[model samples]
Target chain A: MTISDNDDGGGTTVVAGTTGRLTQWSTKRNRWIDAIGISAAIAVALDVYLGIWVTPPDKVQGNLVRLLYIHPAIATVALYVAFPLAALSSALWLWRRTRSPFFDRLAVASVETGIFFIALTIVTGSLWGRPVWGVYWTWDATLTTTALLLLEFLGYIAIRKSTADPERRARRSAIVALVAFVDVPLIQSTMVWWKTLHQKATVLLGSSSQIHGIMAMTFALSFLAFGLLCLWMIINRYRIEAIREELEARRMEDAINDRIAESNIRVDDLLAANTAPANTVRSDI
Target chain B: MAPFALLVLILFAFALGPDRTPLINATPGLFWVAVLFSTMFAIQRSFSLEATEGLHDSIILAGIDPAGFFIGKLLAIGAELGVLEILTAAGIIILYGAHVTSMLVLLFSCVLGTIGLSAAGTMYGALVSGMRLRETLLPLLFLPVASPVLIAGTRSWQAGLAGEHISASPWMWILVAFAVLYICVGVVLYGPMEDM
Candidate 1:
C-alpha cells in the first residue's frame, strides 16, 4: 500500500546543481518581516477595536454577531487566497520554463498557513453555528468541502514527508497538489448548488446579504490585517522550509560522498591484490 | 476485499446487537460502508499491480496511453466492486431483510455511485499506491473526496426505498456529476502523475 511509489521511473536524476546552501536572510529583509508582523498585529488589533468598540451591533443578532468580524476573513484566506496560491505555484512548477524550487517553497508556505486558517475557520464556524443554527455540526456542502480541502492539504503535506529526497519530494508534492486542486472547483460549485445550513458567498458579488455598509468596512479592515498575517506567515514558513531543504540536501550529499569513499577504498584493495601477483613473480623464477 | 467486507458486515450486525429490526434499519449506511472499504482495497490493489517492480516502467516504455490505462484499471476495480456489491446486497437481503423498493433507481444509484467512487479512487490510488503509508493515506485522502458518493448513494437508496411522491431525489444526478468530474480530472492530471 505504498503511496505513489508507482511513479516507477523515479530512477534518481541526481542533478548536482546546488551545494545545499541554507537560506540567508539579510538585515533589510528581517526588518521588512518585522514591519509586516507589526502591521498584521496592529491591523488585527484595529479590527478588533473597530468591531467591538466602533461598529454597531447587529440589529437582530446582538453580540453574537462578533464572529462575523474575523470568520469571513479567515475563511476567505484559507479557501480563496491560500488554495489558489498553492494551485498556481504548482502549475508554475509544472510549466517547465518556470520550474524552480522557489515556487515549491512558496507553495508549501502558503499551504501550511492555509492549514492554520482552515482550522480557525472550522472552529469559529462551528462556534458561530452553535447559536445560529442550533446544531454545531451540519453536513452542509460548504463545510464539507472545507473539511475535505483540509484533508487534501494534510495528504499533500504527508506525501512531502514520506519521500526523503528533496527534489523528488517537491516534484511529487507539486504533482499531488495539482491533482488535488481539481477538487477546489467541484467543492465550490457544490456549495453553490446545494442549499445547506452554511451560506454561500456573501461579499464576493456585492450581494448585500449579511455584510452591509459598516460591516463591509470592518470586513475590509479585517481582511487587510489577516491578509498581511497570512503573507507574513507564508514568508516565515518559506524561509524555514528553505533551511530544512538545505539541511536535507546536505545530508544527502554527505551520504553520497560516504558511499563514493567506500567504493574508492574497495577499488584500491582490488588494485593492490592485482599487483600482488607481480610481486610474487620471484617465487615462480 | 470481499471477505473483509463480509467481516465488516458481520461486525455491523454484531455491534447493532443481533436484532433484525436494528440491522434492517442500519443496513443502508452499513451497506455503503462495506462497499466503500472493500472498493478502496480493490483500488489499492489496482495500483499495487502497476507498482510491481518493472511493470510500470514496461507499460510506460510500451507507450500505453494513460487514459486507456486509467480506464482499464478503473474498470477492473469497478468489476471487482460489482461482485462485492452483489455479495453485500445479498447480505442485506438475508441478514437485514432489506428489500429494493425502486429497482431502477437503486440500480442507477449503485452504478453511478460505483463509477464515481471508482473514478476518484483510481486517481487517489495512483497518487498513494506505493507510499509507505499507503493503507492509511489511501483512506485519509480517498474517504473525504468520495464522501459525496457515499452520501448521494445512500440518499438515493433511502429515497428509492421510501417510495414517496418523489421517485428519487436528484442524487443520481449528483453521482453522475461526480463521476464525470473526477474522470475528467483523471484524464487531465494522471499523465503527469506518472512522473511523480
Candidate 2:
C-alpha cells in the first residue's frame, strides 16, 4: 500500500492500495455540522419551552398532550426519515454500479440513529400512555410494527457485526436491510388489519384543522428540531464509522506486513544457516 | 420434526395448565407457534445438510441455477413443516380437546403458512449458512420477519375452528399474499445471497 498525498484543499488523505483503489480520509470536521448541531439544540429547547409553557392543554387529553411535541416528532424521524434513508443507502450499496463503502457506512449510521430515535419514541410514547391508556405498552398496530422494525434492524446490525470481512458484511447487511424494508409495509398492513388503538395522523396529513394554530406551529417546530438533530447524529455516526473502518484496514495491513517481515527474517536466517560453516551451526544449536 | 413439534404442543398444554377451556381457546395460536418453532429447526436441518460435506460448494461448482436451488430447498423445508404441522395439529386436537369446524380453511391456512415460513426460512438459512453463530442469529433474523405469518396463521386457524369461514378467508388471503411475496423475493434475491 502506498500513501499518495493529494494536495486538495479538502485536507483529504488518499491511501492507494495495491488493487488501485483509493481510500480518502476526511479528518477535518465541517463547520456546517457544528452549525446544524447548535441550531438543533436551540430549536429543541425552544420547542420544548413553547410546548410545555405556551401551548394550552387540550380539552380532551389535558396536560398529557404535552408529550406530543417530542414523541410524534421522534417517531416521525424513526419511521419516515431514518428508515427510508437507511433503506435507500442499502439499495445503493447493493447495486453494482453505485456500490461504495460510503453507502454502507451511511446505512449503519442511519440504522444506529434510527434505533436511538425508536427507543426514544417508545419511551416518550409510553410515558404518555401510562396515564391515558392505563398501560405502558400494548400490542396495537403502530406499536407492534415499530417494535418489529426495531428487532429487524437489530438483526441487521447483528449480521453486520458477525462478519469481519468488510465486503461480505456490506453485502449481507444491505440484503438484510432490503428484506426488512420490504417487510415493513407488509407488517404494517397486516397489523392494521389485526388491531389498532393508536390515534390516526392529524397534523402532517393536512388535517391540521383539528389542532390549534399555535400548537400546530410548535408541532412543526418540533419536527424541524428533531429532523436537524437526526441529521447531525447520522453525520457524526457516519464519520465515526468511516474512522473505524480506516483503522481496521490499517491494522489489517500492518498485520500482513508484520507477517511478511517475519517470514523474510526466517528466510534470511535459513539462508545464513545454510551458507554458514557446519561447525558454527552446531555451536548455535 | 414431528416429534419435536408434538413435544412443543404437549409443552404448551403443560404450561397452560389442565384447564381444558383455556387449552381449547389457545389451541389455534399454540399450534401455529409450534409450527413456527419447528420451521426454524427444519430450515436449520436443511441448510446443515448442505453445510456438511461441502455440498454447497459442489452445487455451485456443478453450475446449478441458484433460483432452482432456492426453490428446491423451499419445497423440501415446506414439505417437512407441512407434515410436522399435521402432527402438531393432531396433538393439539387430542391433548387440548380442540374442535376443528372448517377443515378446508384449516388445511388451506396450513399450506399457505407453511409456504411463507419455509420460503423465509430458506432465504435466511442461506443468508447465514456457513456462519459460526448461525444457530442464534437465524432465529433473531427469522422470527420477526415471520411474525406476520404467525398472526395470519393463528387468526385463520381460530376462525376455522369457530366455523367462521368468512372471517377465515381474509386471514388466509393474507397468508396467500405472504407466501407469494416471500417466494418471489426468495427467487429473485436467493441468487445474490448464494453468491455471497
Candidate 3:
C-alpha cells in the first residue's frame, strides 16, 4: 500500500492525497481578484461621473464627447494585454517546456480581453469618428493597422483552437503570442513612417500641457478600472481552468484505482480456487 | 554580386519609364512593383538557399535562437530590400522630377516598412519552408501581410513626389508600429516552427 519515493521529506501531506491544494490556492486567488475587480468597477463609475458631469467637454468635440472615458482606455488595455502574453508564452516555452494549464488559461483570458477592448476601441473609434471623420471606416493608418493588429491576434487564437493536442496547442500558441507581441510596437510605428490619412498624436500622455485637470483624473481612474477588470478576468479564468485540470487528474486516478481493485480481486479468486482444489483432492481420494 | 546585377537591372527599368506621364506620377506604382517583384525574388531564395546548401539541418541542430534565426534571415532580405529602395530613390530623383525633401523621413519609412515585410515574409517563409507547396503558399501568405506596407509606402512616396505636406513624422510612427507587430509575431512563433 505504500508508495515509495515521496518527495516531501516523507511527511504525510493530506492536501496532496486528494484535495488538490494548488487548485484550492487558485480559488482563493480568484476570490481576492474578484473583490479587487468589483472595487475597480465602482471606481470606473465614479470616474465616469466625474468625467461627464465635472470635466469640461472638449472645445472641438463638445458634450457629445464624454466617450473619452472608454476610447483611450480600451486602446491602452489592448497594448497592455499583448506584452505580458508574449512574456508568458516565451517563459513557458523556454523554461517550463510543458503545457502549463495556468499559462494557457492566462493567455486565453488576456487575448479574449484584448479582443473585447479592441472591438470596443474600434466601435467607439467609429462612433467618435463618424461625428469627427464623417465616415464609419477609412483606410487611415491608425484604423487600418489597428484592424490588422486585431487580425493577427485572431489568427493566434485560431491556430491555438485549431490544434488538437493540448500540449502541442500550448507550445504552438505560445510561439504565436511571442511573435505577435514583438510586432505590436513595430506595427504601431508604420503609420508614422509612411504618410497615412490618420491624424497625429495630440496627447503624449503625462506631458504637462498635453492633458490636465479633470480630464487627466478621469483618464487615470478609467485606466485603473479597465486594468483591474482585465486582471480579474485573467485570475478567474486561471482558477476555473485549474479546477478543470484537478478534476481530470482525479478522474484518471479513479480509473487506475478501479483497474487495480478489479485485478486484485481476480488474483484473490484464483488463490481461493487453487487452495480449495488442493483440499478437495483428499475427499476424492 | 548577383544581387548587385539585379539591382542594376531594376535601375534600368526605372530609367526606361513610359514616355507618357513623367516618372514622378508613374514612379510610385513602378517603385512598389519593383520592390514587390524584387522581394518575391529574394523570398524564393529564402529556404532554398539552406535546402540546396544542406545547411538547414545544421542550423537546427546548432540550437540557435529562433528569434536570432529570424533576424539573420531578415537581415539578408533587408539588405536586398535596402538596395532596391536606394535604386528606387535614385530613380525618383533622376528620372522623375522629384526632390528628396526629407531624406530622414524617406529612409525611416523605407527601413520600417522593410522590417515589416521581412518579418512577415520570414515567418511565412519558415512556416512553409518545409512544406511541399511552399512556393505556392509563400506568395499567398506574403501578399496579405505586405499589403499595408505597399499602400502606405506608395501613398507616402506619392505625397513626397507631389511636394505636398509630407510629414513623415506621423507615418514614421505608424510604420514603426507595423514593424514591431511583425517582429513580435515572428520571434515568438518561428522557433517552434523550426521543429514543425
Candidate 4:
C-alpha cells in the first residue's frame, strides 16, 4: 500500500497493486466459468432430448406444457444465484476497500440477470396459469413474493446507480442487498403459509415420491441447464468488468503521465528563461 | 447489546403473553409482536452502544471490518430474539393452544424472521447513528424495510398453528433471501455510515 500524505488530517492510502490471491481467484473463477458452460450444454441436451421428446406429455396440459421444464428451473436458478451474487458483492465492498468498484458492478450484473430470468419465470408462469387456472395473473403468495423480490433487486440496482461516491455507493447498496434478503423466504413461504392460489410444492424435502422418474429426471436436467446459464452469465459479466477495470487503470496511468510530462516541460521552460537572464547579466558584467 | 435485547424480550413477553395467557388469536400476532418490539429495540440500541463512550472509533481501529461489526451486533440481537421467541412460543403453546405440527418450520421461520429484522435494522441503525433523531428515524426506515418479514412470519405461524396445509418452504426461502439481501446492503453501505 502507498500512503499519500495530505496537509490535512485525512491520509489517502491506495493498495499499490493487485494481490496474488485475487489473480488466482480470478483465474479459478474463469475456469469455473468454462466448466459451467460445458455443464450447461449437457443440461440443455438432456432437457431437450429427454424432457421434450423422450418423456411423455401430461394428459391434461398436453404438448404446450413442455415449457414447464424450463420455467421453474429458471426461476429456481434466478433466486438461488441472486442471493450469492448480492452477498459476495456486498462482502467484497466491506471487507476489502479496493474491490468495491468491481464488486458493485458485479452486483449490478447479478441483479440484471436475475431480473431477466425472473421476468421469464413470471411470464411463463402466467402463461401456464392462464391455461390451468383460467386467469392471466393472480395476487397469489408465490406471485406476489416474486414481484416483490424483483422490485427489491431493482431497488438495489437503482440505489447503486444513484450514488456518486464509490465508497458510499458500495456501502449503501450492500445494505440494500442484505435488507432485501429477508424477503427470499418470506416470498417462498407466502404461498404455502397463506391461502394462496399457487400450487403446493411438487417437490418437498423428504418426499421423493412426489416426483416421478421421468419428470424428476427432466426437472433435474432443467435445473442444471438453468444453473449453467446463471454461471455463464456471471462469468461473462465478471470478465467484461475486469476488462473495463483494466482500461480504467490504464487511463488513470496515462493521465498521470501526461500531467507529469506537462509539469516537466513547464520546469524546463522556466529554467531556460532563468539561464537566459543569467547569461545576459554575465555578458553585461 | 445483551441488556437492550433483554429489555426487548421482556417487553415482547409482557405485550403478547401477559400473565401466562396469550392474547386471543395470538398465533399470528405473536410473531409480529415479537418482531416489532425486537426490531424497535435492536435498531435503537444497535449504534447507541458504539455511539456512547467513544467506542465506535476503537472498533474501527481494531481492524474489525465494519460489516463484521454490524453482523456481531445483529447476532446479539438475534440471540436476544431467540430467547424471547422461546419464551413467547412456550406461552403461546401453553396458553393460546397453538399447534406445532412442524416444529422445524416454526422455529426456522422464527430464526429467519429475527435475522431479517436484525440484518436490516443494523444498517438503518448505522445510517442513523449520527442523526439528531436517530431513535425515531431508525424505526421509520427499519419498519418499512422489514414489513415483508413480519407479514411472512405472521402468516407462516398462523398457517402452522391452523395446520391448514402450511407450506413452510416459501417462508424459509424468503427469510433466507432477506438475510442475504440485508447483509449485502449493510456491507456495501458501512463505509458511508461509518463516515457519517
Candidate 5:
C-alpha cells in the first residue's frame, strides 16, 4: 500500500496511486477506479437480466434483437471512446508539464482494451449480420471501418511490442495512436459513404432520429453498462501495466549490475595480467 | 521507388497475362497499387536515411524544430513520390492503353492522394525506422493503417478514369481530408516521435 515498498532503480511507477501525490489522494484515486469497475460489473449484469428477459422483442426483428444489448455497447466503447482516450493520454504524455508514465501506460492500456473490444465488435457484428445481412462480412462502411480500425491499432500494439524500452515504446505507440485517432474520423466518413449495408447512427450523437419506449431504456442502460465495463477493463489493464513496468525496471537494474561486474573483471585483468597473485585471480571455480 | 512501381506493374502485366483490354480495365486499380507500393518504398528510404549516421540525433541536439523536420521529410517524400507518380501514370497509360477522358480529375486525385500517402507513410516509417525488423515490419504496420487512403485513393482514381456517371468532388474531398488529417497529426506528434 505504501509508495516505496519496493523500489528498483527509481522505477517511479506511475499510477494514480503512485504519482507522488499524498497517500490519501492516491488511495482515494485507486478506490475510485475500482469503484467504477464494481459498478460497471453490476450494471452489466443487470443489463443482461433486463435486456435478455425483460425487454420486449422488437416488433420486426423479434428476439434476435438481443444482440442489441452487447453489439452497440461494445462498438461504441471500442471504436468511438477508447481511441479518443488513448489519443488524449498520448498528447498529455508528449507535453512536459503534464507528462507522466501514468499517461504512457494509460495510452497503451486504452489501445489494448480498445483492440479487444473492436475485435469483439467485429465478431458480434458478424454474428448479428449473418442472420440479418445474409453474409458474415460485407463491404459496408461501418464494418470496413471497424475492421480497419482494428488493424490500425494492431499496428499500434505491434509498435509497442517492437521495442523493450518503455519510454521509447510509449513515444512510438503514442504517435501511432494519435495518427490512428485522426485517421479514424476520415476513415469512418469515407467508408460509410463508400458503401454500407449497416444502419446509420441510432443511439449516439448526430442521429436526428431516436429510439423510444422500453427498447430505449434497455439500450441506454446497456450503453452505460458497456461504458463502465470499458472503464473497468482499462483501469485494471493500466494497473497491470504499471506493475509490468516496475518489473522491467528491476530487470534492467539487474542487467546493469551484471555489466558492472563484467567490466570490473575486465579492468582488473587489464591492470593485473602480470602482477596479480595466482590465488587472488577472479575465481570461476 | 520508380523501379519498384515498374516492377509491380510488370508483375501485374504478367499475372493478368496479355489481355490488353482487361489490363486497360484494371488500369485504375493497378495504377494506385503501384503508387501505393512506391510510396511505401519512398517512406522506408526516407526514414532509413534519417536514422543513419546520428543524423536524427544531431537534428534533435541542434534544436531544429521537430515539426519542421517532419514537414521537410513530408515534402521531400511528397516531392519524390510526385515524380514517381508521373512515371507510374505514364506506365499505366502506355502499358494499359488507358484512354483518359477526365484529365483534370485524374491529376487532382494523383496530387491529393500522394500527399496523403506520403504524410502517413512518413510517420509510420519513423515509427518503425529504428527497429531490426523495420523492413518486414513497416509494411505490416503501415498498410493496414493506410487502408483508408487505399480505399479513398482507389475511389478517386476510379472517379477520374471512369467517373462519367458520377462526380469526383466527394472522393477528392476524402483525399483532402486524409491529407490534412495526417499532416496535422504528423506536425503535432513529430515532436514526441523525434524526442528520443
Candidate 6:
C-alpha cells in the first residue's frame, strides 16, 4: 500500500515492500517508548511505596500527606507540562514557517493525554480533599479554573470532530488550542488574588522548607514518573493519529479506484449494447 | 436579545421562588447572567446575518480590512448587548425590587463588560460560523472563555449595587484588561480566521 503525504508535506511513501526497514525503525522507537513506560510504572510504584510505607507521617496531617506524592505530580503534568506543550505545538502549526501536520498531531496527542491527567488530577484531588478539606469540591480559583480548562479542551476535541477535512480540522483546532491557552494565565493570576482552600505549591517551587527528606525525594520521583507516563501516552497517541490518517487516505484512494472501475464497466456495457444489432434495434424502438 | 434577556431575568425569579430577599440580593448576578446568555443569541444573530446570505465571503472579497470587519461586528453586537443589558437591569430593578446604589460603577461595568463579551463573542462566532454544528458548538467554545467576564462583571455589579464604588473599581480594571486583550487578539487574528 502507498500513501501520499499531502497532509504532512513529507512526500509519498510506500507502506508494504519497505516493511522490513520501517518495522526496524518503528521497533527501535517503540523500544524506547516501552522502556519509558516501564520506568514510569516502576517509579510510580516506588513512589507509592516510599510515600505510604517508608516516609514518616507528617507532623500535622499524618498519613494524609501521602497524597502529596500523587496529586501535585499529576497536576504538574496536566496543567504545566501537557497543556503548555499542546499550546506550543498549536502555535507552531499556526505559524506559516513551522506549519506541519506533525505539530497538529502533537497538539492533539498532548491535549488528549493532558485531559486524562487532568481527570486523574481532579479525581485524586477530590479524594484527598474529602478527608482534609471536608468536602469533595469547592469554588476555589484553582478548582474552578481547572474545571474550565477541562471544559475548554473538551470543546477543542468537539471542534476537532466537527470537521472531516484534515486540513480544516487541524487549522480550526490549532486556533482553538491557542485561544483556550489564554486562560492559563487568567487561571494563574486568579489563584493569586482569590482566596483558595487549596494548598500553595511547595515542592516544585523549591520551597522544600515545608517538605524535606524522603518525602521530597518521593515527591520528585512521582513528578518524574507522571511526566514520563504523560510523555509515553502522548507518543502512543501521536502514533495512533498518524496511523488513522494513513488508513483514511488509503480508504479514500480505494474508493476513488472503485468509482473509476465502476465507470469503466458502464462504458463497456454501453459499447457491448452498441455492437449488438438486436439490442440496438430494441433501443431504437 | 432584549426579550431573551427579560425572559432569563423572569425565569430566575420563578426559579428562586417568591422570596424577594434572595432575588434582591442576587440582582447583580442575575442581570449579568441574563446578559451573558443573551450575548450568545446576539452573537448568533450577528453571524447568521452574514452567514445566511454568504456575506462573510463577499466582505472578504470586497477588499474590506478583516480588522475593520471584526471591529464593526464587535461594535454592532456590543450595541445590541448594551440595550439588552439595560432592559435586563430594569427587569431586575422592577421585578426583583433591587436598588442600584452606584450607577456609575454599574454603567462602567456594563460598558466594559459588554466590550469584552462582544469582542470575544465576535471572534468565536467567526471561528465557528462556517461549521454545521455552530449553534451547539458556539456556546461550548464560548462560555468557558467568557467565564472571566461573567465573574468580573458579576462581582463589579455586586459591589456597584452595594454602593461600594471603590471596591468595584478593580473588577472594572479586569474588565478593561480583558476587553483590551480580546480586542487586540481579534483584530490580529480575524484576518487569518477569515481566510480559513
Top of the candidates by TM-score? 2
- Per-residue lDDT of A103-139 in model 4, one digit per residue for the tens? 7767767877888889989999988888888998997
Which parts of model 1 have CA positions greater than 4 angstroms off? Answer: A1-32, A188-195, A199-216, A257-285, B164-169
Q: Is model 1 an incorrect, acceptable, medium or high docking prediction?
A: acceptable
Model 2 chain A worst lDDT run, 10 consecutive residues: A276-285
Whichever of 1 and 4 has more DockQ, that candidate is: 1
What fraction of the real A-B contacts shows up in model 3? 0.22
lDDT of 2 by residue, A116-214 (tens): 999889889889989999999998999999999999999999998998888889988988998898999889989999999998886656646578688
Q: Where's the lowest-lDDT run of ten residues in candidate 2 chain B? A: B1-10
* TM-score, structure 2 vs. true: 0.92
The parts of candidate 3 lying over 4 Å away from their true place are: A1-21, A27-30, A52-56, A81-92, A95-101, A196-215, A241-285, B1-119, B125-192
Local error of candidate 5 at residue A250 (angstroms): 1.4
Interface DockQ per candidate: 0.40, 0.81, 0.16, 0.13, 0.65, 0.69
Ranking by lDDT: 2, 6, 5, 1, 4, 3
* Per-residue error (Å), model 2, residue A81: 1.0
Each model's lDDT comes to 0.78, 0.85, 0.66, 0.67, 0.78, 0.83
Using DockQ as the measure, which candidate wins? 2
**Candidate 4: segments with Cα more than 4 A from true spot:** A1-16, A19-32, A88-112, A164-166, A186-195, A205-213, A266-285, B1-192
For B1-196, candidate 5 gives per-residue lDDT tens digits of 6687778788999999888988877887787777778878888778777777778778778888878988889889989988988888888887778888788888888889888888888888887877887887788777776776677777767777775526678888888888888888788777767655
> Could you tell me the TM-score of chain B in model 3?
0.83
Q: List the residue pairs that clash in candidate 1.
A: A2-B129, A2-B130, A2-B131, A3-B128, A3-B130, A3-B131, A4-B128, A4-B129, A4-B130
* Model 6 interface CAPRI class: medium
Error of 2 at B173 (Å): 1.5
Clashes of 4: 37
Per-candidate TM vs. native?
0.84, 0.92, 0.59, 0.54, 0.84, 0.91
Q: What is the lDDT of residue B24 in candidate 1?
A: 75
Which of candidates 1 and 2 is the stronger one according to TM-score?
A: 2
lDDT of 2 by residue, B1-196 (tens): 6668777877887898989999999888888888888888888998898889798888999998889998889998888887787788788788778888999999999998999999989989989988988999999999999999999999999999999999987788888888988899899888888877
Candidate 1 local lDDT, B65-148, one digit each (tens) = 998888877888888888888888877787677776777777778888888889889988887766788888888778867777
